[model samples]
Target chain A: MSSKIRIEDARRFRVGDGFRLSDVDPTATPGFSGSDKDLKKELVQHDEEIGVLQEKLHAEKQNSLLIIAQGMDTSGKGGLIKRLLDPMSPLGYRVQPFGRPTEEEAAHDFLWRVERALPKPGEVVCFDRSHYEDVLVQKVDALAPAEEIERRYGAIVEFEQQLAERNIMLIKVMLHISKDFQKENLRDRLQNPEKLWKFDPSDLNARAEWDEYMDAYQIALERTSTETAPWYCIPGDNKDYARAVVKHLVVDALRTIDPQYPTPDFDPKAELATLESMD
Target chain B: MSSKIRIEDARRFRVGDGFRLSDVDPTATPGFSGSDKDLKKELVQHDEEIGVLQEKLHAEKQNSLLIIAQGMDTSGKGGLIKRLLDPMSPLGYRVQPFGRPTEEEAAHDFLWRVERALPKPGEVVCFDRSHYEDVLVQKVDALAPAEEIERRYGAIVEFEQQLAERNIMLIKVMLHISKDFQKENLRDRLQNPEKLWKFDPSDLNARAEWDEYMDAYQIALERTSTETAPWYCIPGDNKDYARAVVKHLVVDALRTIDPQYPTPDFDPKAELATLESMD
Candidate 1:
């Protein structure tokens, strides 16, 4: 059987002023196949080019990136962080994994801790969970005053703007895993001994409040997606595909940044080969 | 053919103290084979219980670490950084690959920039080359005042003491390759086309003043090696062996600091299994 696919067909993504996060299909499969096998095949195809691109960025050492992976628990943050950073040189990159803020941090502005964690020029910083935690968790749990929650969002955008102004590129990835995926993920962790350390009982309470969290995320995306930094909603049900999408975004952004070597006065290739003879 | 090796025999190193930087035998094959290999192996091998130790320390997340590497033009800073970090999770790690200091950085005290790169609780920060730059490069080129040069070493030790007080463990490495190996490396860069970008013509000019630079490095290491953050003089001609040695040093230090997971309030495995079934 043969079928015609329109150029404008399902691949098009719209984020209207009035669009709600729920209105967006959290589980909507965009491509021909939703299978993880298809994603592995597609992702592996770009491996060589992507590897070259990574080397180019490392060599150029121009732009510093702070990759914010913000999703609820079980959103594939850990897995995504591993895959994207695995191929690249760890020398110029870093990751900040935040849990609850310290008392000293809470006493100060939310961004203070993050400011300390930001990568210098020519470095890349990955935030497994970042400042957004204040807004997301605080809003859903009613842990803070309503005014305080509202203020944090504006504070986040302002902080991000300052980073952009300073030539730091920020990538905000919302690992959009559906409730179904979360349930299955939680189940897998239960049966597996190795994954025992990952299971948290309170996750059930979070799932109970899933709809409320969704509404909160909707507003979070709507308010925060700015011109300098746009939110890339990654369909994360299939873990491998989510990884591929994030890696695509990372390499594409690096390509845009285009890292280049600092023109050392001598030929490096010849220099490297000198060791070949010593063998 | 088997003979008993004594403890002192095993712990003994080839080159003694007071050797110049280029005096290091980069081409000397490390004990990678034979009885001598087994004799010296224990000195190189720290406790292999590193993983178990790290897991315990992962819980308290108490002490942080910073590994700083500094040396001349062909010194093995980049390679050192890679081997140290290759085994660990990139999640709680940061690397600062400093080039020329920014004017803003130069305006501040030399330690300010380096201080800013310190890792937080339970994280590790590796500097491919660090603040010792002002002393090393400046001394070699007569770029800084002798008074200023002398003062910073004491200040650097104090800076490291502060880090140690704050529970930041520091490990410094100076990869010592002999003048012979460096000459071979420089020639390789000049002769190969692929290494064109890395070739710096004046590397030979710098190599010409080899002894002067070695004296500078010797002074830097002597002044800065302290109880809290001692320096390791790694004989680095054998690239693979150097990588292996640095890898084990990191493992050794990290194991001693150790890491442990925080006790979960709920069984993560059970939670994960439940989540997996939600679909």
Candidate 2:
């Protein structure tokens, strides 16, 4: 029998902090020994703040927030979003899964396709895989050149700035899973039938050049983290710790928004007959 | 023999078109009329646009839209959203069913609770019965005075303006089902198990004073319609016609959005390598 539950429990704190070298199981290198108590405490405040901001934003009907997540083949983007947004009100939240560009999409400029999915005000939209693929995969596949990638990073800044100027919040997340952790993730997918579809053979090819992709991501982080749209590199070896961090970031962002109620309209009188009748 | 299909079709429309007219046969409303040829042609264009938006938005990976339907008790909100958004992308979109306001909501401003449900930017949110209920129900029960209703209307306008400022497109639908049509709707609901949940004997109380609600709605439309958001009074008697109008509105909105793809980045060596590999 496998020690799955123990490993699962250990997976929660295997990042940020240094893990005990002696306890490192043969399955994969453990990250850090973290305290769930700390993680739980941190998440409570964040969850509350998000709740308030969500309500305020909806009521104010003000700026909407869009979150875009991108990372390596097994970077845990899906897991990150799930944990980060679980506490949000289901009514105003949306999660969009990205896939291959369609024929119509191919006809338009890369950003054209994205512009159409912009959320209405007072909503939160999360991109599982964003336009970064144009740079990430295109460069990996030689579909695009460095000049194009450089241009996109700078252009992204402008695009994001415009949204910020108009009050649409933009947040980007990159799940940083180590090569060793990724292999474990791949193993999980392979062994489990339920997760089999998630594993694409192409992902194996991509994993081979992991270091090159890391360089690309490093450049992406440095070039794209702007005042308008900031990027957070989350540690993914420890799922719980990662969730804790993401939770904090989202709540912090929402609380900082501090939306207010639209001004009240009805007065105490004028319809005196009606008010009296309800009583 | 009862015409179930006609009743089903009628449920798809906005309220108040055929009910006030002379006696209704109650049996002849089912078949899809070929007379609406021009409208059908327009719907095809709308359908094409929708497909384009669905593709483009999916690629962009930015945000989602929520459409909320809100109206008088017998309003056809549920039917409209179900048919309109069903085929698009259910994963990226959501429909929230709001029951009576909670005590917490009543304690705050009328818009307080609703604020929690607004969609994020670049999203479409439809309200079945939104904050307007404060004006509608309050007016009906004499719970709130005229001054209060006017004030709430202003709040709604400000709230919508803020939503537009952010990116969420707002569409408020007031399904204007007539008194007789409402009776038929109630009868159908009671007769069908699937629809019984929608029926409430209390809905009959307001039916006695249909003109009062009409006047209230007219005031709502007059006060709340703005450039940021517009109020459409859909005719509920004819189901297909109503669906057509809604489909037209959605298509019109998406056309205005005209989403695009993000620019890509590239490297010359990488590009050359990819091209050489492909060759």
Candidate 3:
């Protein structure tokens, strides 16, 4: 019955032709309706299901999954990763948080660090802030020339297509929080003693150009979201609702993968007897 | 009082100035003496301490940690990581397992991938197999010319020193197991149907050249173990003991870092009052 939750409706959040970030209300939970308690209970069930699906994926050892989380600071990327993916077996799941490029990373092409962090077969990898940073921050800040920024969008499409061809499923999510929501989150961080360490004064510089960033995200989502790797702009002002939607989407993807326990190539009865006889 | 445990003595297992892999007993627990129950309990305490230290490290947002785990097949690198590091916060730690080089990776210098995988500040990263693979497997297989192999030794020393200067603490560990122990482990894998996915026939090829691999490790350790990054040859025959030793070493390094709860730049009382006043 939970399978009937229709997570595919999340595609409604997908960027399509002429998609605008301004059109969507960050406070809207597009598909589901439940009290906070009910939503959390549902998330627990999804977690268990995801855990089981991951074990199957690990056992099958064929396909891989890559989930990319992109958003502005305080958009809840860390919270989503901690709550959703961290509970899974670390053997088969990895979380790669991309931050400021090191001098060494800067020397290489933009995608090199991203390519290096890719999931191996049967592994699920989440990118906290990913290659999208190049297009977003780099574009808004004019770190790269306009021409180069355009070129990267094409490059991302090709890179993601290659991954899909190699049996890697790609899920790109942008946590869509309103400018007002961001202000509240930033203010909360500034006013919490325990959270002060996470507060970077430089974030205000980004906030000053909020409109430019939204424009950058709009253009990026339009250009890079392809059949192989579609981008979803999840409404993130309601953190709990956003988390629920993400859980459903991930569950739906795993269900589509539907990995089964691998059949043993060798005779199981003989191996079991041998194992039994071993000292 | 547990801090009195000297994890540095793990260096007793170090491949010193004039060391031979043949000199060490793989079955021996060099610096620890405890029952399995006691070891597990101790590991739990260390895990809790590690959790606390990692929180401080994250809060401080300064120095980084890079832990390299190198071992032959069935030496329990995966097991050690799952048992020890996986329980910690995924927010501040990463596990990278390097397998055979891809065509793209092979295009770059040996250290290119290693450089890419280095930890950012306030993060702890573990490499399941690392650049040492270039020296170990590549040397044994004669994949590189003799001159190039010699050059990598110097490159590694310089590279590690640079990392040290950059404030990355490097802990290099070699899970040491005897050839006889490896045979038993391989047999166990072969006889276990559930673990068949992990059984790779190519591992047999590597096993055939065990002596050459040992020689390669000996030369590598002798060449690269410096004050900044030291190699500890952890006994792998008793998986529990190796894990305990690793836990102690990691805890000791974290204790040395001694990252404190960062002081708030703003007045906590005023901020708390402001936060309470907000809707």
Which structure among the candidates has the greatest TM-score?
1
* Every candidate's CA RMSD: 6.3, 14.9, 5.9
Residue B133 C-alpha lDDT in model 2: 71
Looking at model 3, residue A255 earns an lDDT score of: 89
lDDT of 2 at A88: 58
lDDT tens readout by residue for model 1, A152-180 = 87887788888888878988888888887
The CAPRI classification for model 2 reads as: incorrect
Clashes of each: 49, 75, 0
lDDT of 2 by residue, A12-57 (tens): 4222233322232322323334466654554454566676677667
DockQ of each: 0.30, 0.06, 0.23
Cα lDDT, all candidates: 0.69, 0.62, 0.82
Q: CA lDDT of B28 in candidate 2?
A: 32
Superior candidate under lDDT, 1 versus 2: 1
Stronger candidate by DockQ (1 vs 3) = 1
Candidates sorted by lDDT, best first: 3, 1, 2
Q: How far is candidate 1 from the true structure (C-alpha RMSD, Å)?
A: 6.3
lDDT of 3 by residue, B151-226 (tens): 9999999999999888898889999998889878877777665566666666777887888999998899989988
Off by over 4 Å in 2: A1-33, A37-41, A265-279, B1-93, B96-279
Interface RMSD of each: 5.4, 12.9, 5.1
